[model samples]
Target: MQLFIGNINGQFGELEAEETQHFSRVLRGKLGQEIYLTDGKGTLAKGVVTEIHNKSIQLELSEIQENFEQRPYFLHIAIAPTKNIDRIEYFLEKATEIGIDEITFLKSFHSERKNINLERCQKIVNAAVKQSLKAYVPKLNDLTKFTDFVAQDFSETKLIAHCEEDFERKNFKEILQPNENYLILIGPEGDFSLDEIKLAEENGFQGISLGHQRFRTETAALNAVFGLDWAN
Candidate 1:
């Protein structure tokens, strides 16, 4: 099915500018042709191409389906933004495709990148959601300090991925409880400092290993995502 992204709330609506390009140039949607749209908020609406303009296309909704079985549990990944912006973007796209509810770029003591292109990241995730045919858009939160992020009241199974060999960690399969919200922490290239790790532990974030192999920040974040998917 050709899935477009838009809102058809009151019987009629128009595709957003970014979506208009796909409607005309990529999909070549024709008037009267049936199309599908998701608000990326769990609602999928069936609509027909009503009018094709130069830059925007009008749509009329016919039917709507709400997704209720969106992952029984929440998987929120909080990771330090990689030095290379592309690396973080790669992780964002892949993780969104795989399935994620929330993502937060963190500012860590060892982190190289302080801020990320919020708008760009949003577009990447939005495109991934449509490409992967997902109804819910994984939210991209503002960059947060490591200590501040961990201190917040989060889901039951809060985990922090680290490369320290001395730290006691367990496989997610052995620790994760199904159907409960989860918040995972992934550090940067330099990894988390001893103090930051301790802070997380104090905040009830358990140490979790993504296996023995050392992984980059992006890889570790994606690994955490797959780990939760497996547990689910």
Candidate 2:
């Protein structure tokens, strides 16, 4: 199925401006041709092209599916952005394909990169969702301070992945419960500072380990997402 993102209401919908060129010009979509549409909010529809213009492509919806392929578990990963933006973007794309619900870029004491382009990251994830045939789009949050993020109340299972051997840490796989919401924290290249780990523990976050081998900032974050995904 060739899926495009759009808002569908009742029996009609219109593609966004950016998608117009791809659908009408690039793809050479013709009037009366059938196409798929998704709102990235668990709504998928099959529609026929009704009108095609420079700014938009209008569709007459025929079939609609709600909660399309919704995952049973919710996985949210908050990690420090990598120095090389490509690595973090790679994580976002892969995680979206492997199934992730939300992401947050962290600003920590040991963080190498303190900023992120939310727009670019969102585009990567949106493309991944369509490529992977997923109806829901993962939520992307702006860079947040480590202290402030840790202090927030979350009902999901909270975990912090760090390499500090001095602190007792549980295996990430063992900490997961099927069909439950999870929020995991991955640190920077230097890993989370001891004080940061201690502070997170105080805020009801448990420390977790992703096995013996050490992974990069982006790798560890993806590992956390994959671990929860497979566990469920």
Candidate 3:
């Protein structure tokens, strides 16, 4: 199945500009050919190409599926952006392909990279969604300060993954509950500061450990994603 990204709400819709290039220039898509388009908001549309113009293509919708391939649980991972941006990019791609509901780049006290190129990260996510044939688009947020992000009430299962050995940490697996919304925090290379951990704990966030083996920022984030998938 050839899947493209587009917002198809009614009988007629247009493909995004980049998608048009992929359809016409790369794939040589022609009119009347059937293709699938996803808005990345749980809407999967099957449509026939009706018109192809410069930098755009019109579609006549045949079928639409809402909540397409929706998962039982929602996962949100907020992780400190790694110094090497590529590592975080890899995590985003793989996590999206595997399945994720939301992602927020974190700027922690120990964070090496203070800024992130959200556009590039979003492109990677979009491509992964197409490649993985996933209907829901993971909600991506810009770089957020650790303190500010922690202060919000997620109203879900909240967890913080850190390497603070002095403080007793709960095994992530022990706290897994089916079909519950989750928000997990992954700290930077140096891990969350004692003060930051305390702040999180005070705000109802439980500190948990992914495993005995310590992982890098990106790897730990991905592990949390996988753990959630496995648990559910």
Model 2: CA > 4 A from native? none
Query: Which lDDT values do the candidates have, in the order given?
Result: 0.84, 0.89, 0.89
TM-score-sorted candidate list, best first: 3, 2, 1
Q: Looking at model 1, which ten-residue stretch has the lowest summed lDDT?
A: 61-70
Stretches of candidate 3 exceeding 4 Å from the true structure: none
What is the TM-score of candidate 1? 0.89
Error in Å for residue 35 of model 3:
1.2
> Candidate 3 lDDT, tens digit per residue, 32-80?
9999888888988888999999888999887788899898999999989
Q: In candidate 1, list every pair of residues with a backbone clash.
A: none
**Among all windows of ten consecutive residues in candidate 2, which has the lowest summed lDDT?**
223-232
Q: Write the per-residue lDDT of candidate 1 for residues 2-96, one digit (tens) a residue.
A: 77777657677677778888888887778998877887778777788888888788888867778723887888899899999999999999999
